[model samples]
Target: MATEEKTLVEILEENNLIDLAKYVNYVSASQAGAIATFSGTTRDTFEGKTVVELRYEAYVPMAIRQMKSICSSARSSWDIHSIAVAHRLGTVPVGEMSVFIAVSAVHRADALDACKYLIDELKASVPIWKKEVYSNGEVWKENSEFMDRKLELGKTNGSCCRRNVKVETHGTKSCCGAKVKVADGAAAEISTSDAGTEETI
Candidate 1:
């Protein structure tokens, strides 16, 4: 079985900005033919509200773990070379990047799709939460897409796939939609289905 280890996941400290080039450079590989990226920035407005900024928080340890699992899942699903993901904490003004992702692969399709998957999964499942601050007030927000994904998971597999299940090395806990193998100092993806009854990393 083939495995990749070139993955970088970081939750930036308070007031630290995301370095766009750092991640892109990390994923740059000689064997890679394509590089894809996604940047989540705070917009100036939301639903007729004048936004001032956005604030983010997270359980740092678990956030990094979940991010690694997500990257591992992408590697199993695509032929990718390297992956990089970064998320910002603290106040982020409008037009500033809050999240950035970079993916490199031997083909454009792999990089493109993996890039999309990384951001989607991060937004939906990561421990990091965000609050939107408007001119009038501020409120913590949840991703609606994540809620939808949870409903879908409930309809198909059990709650294990959608909720944050503690991943055990040899124990009987599953993961978020992917069969993750926790071994060799990394979380590697093995399969995508049968997550309800089987033990996933």
Candidate 2:
């Protein structure tokens, strides 16, 4: 299958609910020995403030492009089968999922690792903005991962990211974690990460 067919990316319209089963089944394949998933839901509170809902907005074309790039990055680091990523727009009430990712591979490790990479990259690089509505008021929010990526980019001048085995990209100007040294038109990537370690990017 082509890349378009292998990877499913969607930005749900307003008032639409993400069908978890649809995504779960999308990555299911006979060759896949493992299917890993991640669901990001809105909680009832943040910093002790009661949250009414989460509002999201994104540049759909750019978001999809970035998501596809992230999926390709995951595949570059691991042996993967298929990837499906979805995010909600408009409003997301507390306890409802706002973002979801599903990845499949031949081994548990590959699927698990790719799933982590997909969500992390989506947060770090995708052109999605969020707002948190509290019972009293609403405030715009920026993901910590997104902020960290900005810091990382400021520290480097090169383009094209390659996340390292440690899940920390060095010498990379890109927001997505990747150890790429772009000097004199040369670049390299660090593939994979320590399974025992938690994701940082």
Candidate 3:
């Protein structure tokens, strides 16, 4: 007899706009009592600067791989039934969504926690890079999650298990023991990890 998989994970990275409804529907199941989601959207202003739009680039293959790993980790930590993640590349206008995640579980806690974990880990560990474009000028912004992870790596001398995660830092030759170059005119994507509070429905 063939053994069934314990959890189902779905990941997508594309240059086209993401369809939130599709993901929300995909993770919905009869057995799932709760569905938690995170939608990362572009904001209008940053640091008091007028923003035009945001740009995102990723090492697609590696990004998807890391996302899968994060999903697996979430499954191990929680009794999640399914997960669906989608990230948009290219240009995402202000007030538009850049990333979306959905998680389903038998209970609300597992769904909510796994949804949050998926986004946080994705921001912290994934190789996707974001650039913020302002009216006057533009700059590549680093996520707080990424910066914290970088600092933790330095403190442990890159000896930690999560040290293998590579983060891109501005004006630096190395991040998390990996070399990277910061590109100019880069816009900041979604940096807030909270994604609002969990809603029961």
Which candidate's TM-score is highest?
Answer: 2
Question: Which residue ranges in model 1 land beyond 4 Å of their true spot?
Answer: 1-5, 151-201
As for candidate 2, its clashing pairs are 162-178, 162-179, 163-178
Error of 2 at 14 (Å): 0.8
lDDT minimum window of 10 residues, candidate 3: 192-201
- Local distance difference test, each candidate: 0.70, 0.69, 0.65
lDDT of each residue in 1-201, candidate 2, tens digit only: 322227877767555677899888888887787999999999999999998787776555555667778988898999998888888777788889989999988899999988988998999988677777777766666666776796787843323222221322222121222212233311122112221111112
lDDT of 3 by residue, 32-68 (tens): 8899999999999987888777766664445555677
- Give the number of colliding residue pairs in candidate 3: 6
Better of 1 and 2 by lDDT: 1
lDDT tens readout by residue for model 1, 42-133: 99999998988877765555566778899889989999888888887667889999999999998999999999999999977776666677
Report the lDDT of model 1 for residue 105.
Answer: 93
Q: List the residue pairs that clash in candidate 3.
A: 131-186, 131-187, 131-188, 132-186, 132-187, 132-188
Off by over 4 Å in 3: 1-15, 155-201
TM-score of each model, paired residue for residue? 0.73, 0.74, 0.71
